[model samples]
Target: MTIMPNNPPIFSTRKIDLFVPEREELASVLQNGLRYHFVEATVEWVDCPDLTQEPFNLATSGLCGDAVISEISGMSYLFPFMESEFQYSIKRIIKEIYNNFNNGLIIGASICLRLQQQYLVQLGELIMNASFSRITEDDIEIINKSHLAFLDETTGRCALESITNSDPHCYPHGNFFISEGKPGQVLKVRAKKRIGLQFLTALQYSLEKKYSSGIYPKLIGLGGTFVMKSGRARHHIMPYNWDNNLTNARSIHNWLHYCDLDAPLVAVGTLLSSNLVYKDACKFSDLEVCGLTETHFHTFSSNGAAGGHFYTDLESMDPVEYLGYFYPARIFNHVDPRPSCNELIDFTDVMRLATI
Candidate 1:
């Protein structure tokens, strides 16, 4: 996936396991380049907004009454916020069985948008890997005031921070030690004798070896909770949010191209927030609070789509699932605006597939 201004690149990362498929589709889409207009012709997916917690009362629009289940991909779902208006016309329900290739894990899917035949295009590189959201006042404070600190890699303990006030405990970890850096005065992440000095050496060495040819210091953080902003005379922290740009729709889709989502692929086009964490398609515009503004936070809206390693791990025995993340998109690839009348396997009755 290619990254552009105002859009963050979403990437799924996994432990270095060469056995897994190599990451091929690294960069894909941009923000301004995106155009979305919902049409009933978009009848494929809609979690009818009729639930109690909903801010808008959509029931009056003749969209309420009766909770229903949508059976797809050999599974069932019921979003109370939704109603019977959009039921999958049970074309034909038959008893069918197959092997649980993913060991009961929820499978995820990569969305194929009908817009512009987008999936057919070539993958591009991300020009910038930083969040393009309007940097907030709070974000500036976190960057300028040294609110973030790195942990001791070994003990994993303030581990270290840029000396802000007259904290005699920690020495100034910078190049010029001036209030702000000059044009080319780049500040390096340094640890005091008391801090994780050993860790500092290892971290710098590791980053140098891994990233190779880069003179700039890296800003590291886990989600939106913690941040470590590297200071450079010419550098200023704009704004970065994990939910906003951790991964994009194409990153995970590209990565999952070869791998089988099986059951754990429960939400790819939430492709994911790890273990080759994929950010799913159509997830861009549907979040309540996307960690950028006060409205919503997260990439996939699936609890930020980073549900930890359990749902991401390939061999994870207990993979979890979360429905209702995608608004206009359905868990089932084909929504069949007209419920099926033909003979189809009944996903709800798992026992039917059982041995006699």
Candidate 2:
């Protein structure tokens, strides 16, 4: 007698891990980001004093809500306040997870904010490796100065400034030191000594080694959180630049290629971040699958296309999903309209893939 066989879906687990070392810190970072930008963080993997405290409501001109979790479209979210928030949130989550899961972990983390992608990726690299750096005096100075600007605003908007400054416990003091959870010592995480690109590369290399040996897990989760800024030097939509630059795209492409090079192949693409949908398609290069962004969601969703990883539209394939930052381009064009010809040129491939 002949027997029929069944195949498991490419991705089926859709549980995203959300965390906050405490509520106040989380609220402050999230609220501050929203005051400056429209989008909010979908997840907070790591919690720092700066990104944890609740911001003052006075800044909203009486418009701000009490909690960081605000409702929109019938869903609650942590709004994007500043670009830096993205990096802080992503790094925290990744570091916490990596410390616990190590190489066996395969999920990816992302900030819902569109502009913070670059910084988010930068911090992710730091988290992947067990590295920490002390926050510089200059960095502290800039943060304080920014807070002052927030304070200079009018009374009705005083709440905005308060939120930015509310987390006195975390900011400079919290960031300068690390946790003292180790044995025989109250260790502090130095802000100066941090993980860099080499660390991330080393991690990838290590993961590849294990995957090749068939000792690694096939599925992983991805998500992150951060603030947003839109006025001058640090524009609100800056994070999305990573999406257009082909950074993640190339990464996925390379990852897929690595599999061809003989490593155990793990399906790539975002396990989280909703709006950015991926079209399922046939796998292409390792980089294509390994490296990804919100836009790549399209290519990721396409069923059986070519160029990156396995072919198949991972459409709503759900592992865990979240986007800590994003903007409504349709309505805020003046601030974040479609990129100019030059900018568009930089992201052609990513744009083509995810329809971002």
lDDT of each: 0.16, 0.18
Runs off by more than 4 Å, candidate 1: 1-44, 48-311, 328-356
Off by over 4 Å in 2: 1-197, 212-356
lDDT over C-alpha atoms for residue 70 of model 1: 17
- Give candidate 2's TM-score: 0.19
Candidate 1 lDDT, tens digit per residue, 69-188?
111211111111112122221111100111111111111111111112453321110000011111332121111112222222344221212212311111110000001111111111
Best by TM-score: 2
**lDDT (tens digit, per residue) of candidate 2 on 299-350:** 1111211111212212232221122211111000000111122222122243
In the order shown, what is each candidate's alpha-carbon RMSD? 27.8, 21.9
Worst 10 residues of 2 by lDDT: 328-337
Superposition TM-score, candidate 1 onto the true structure: 0.15
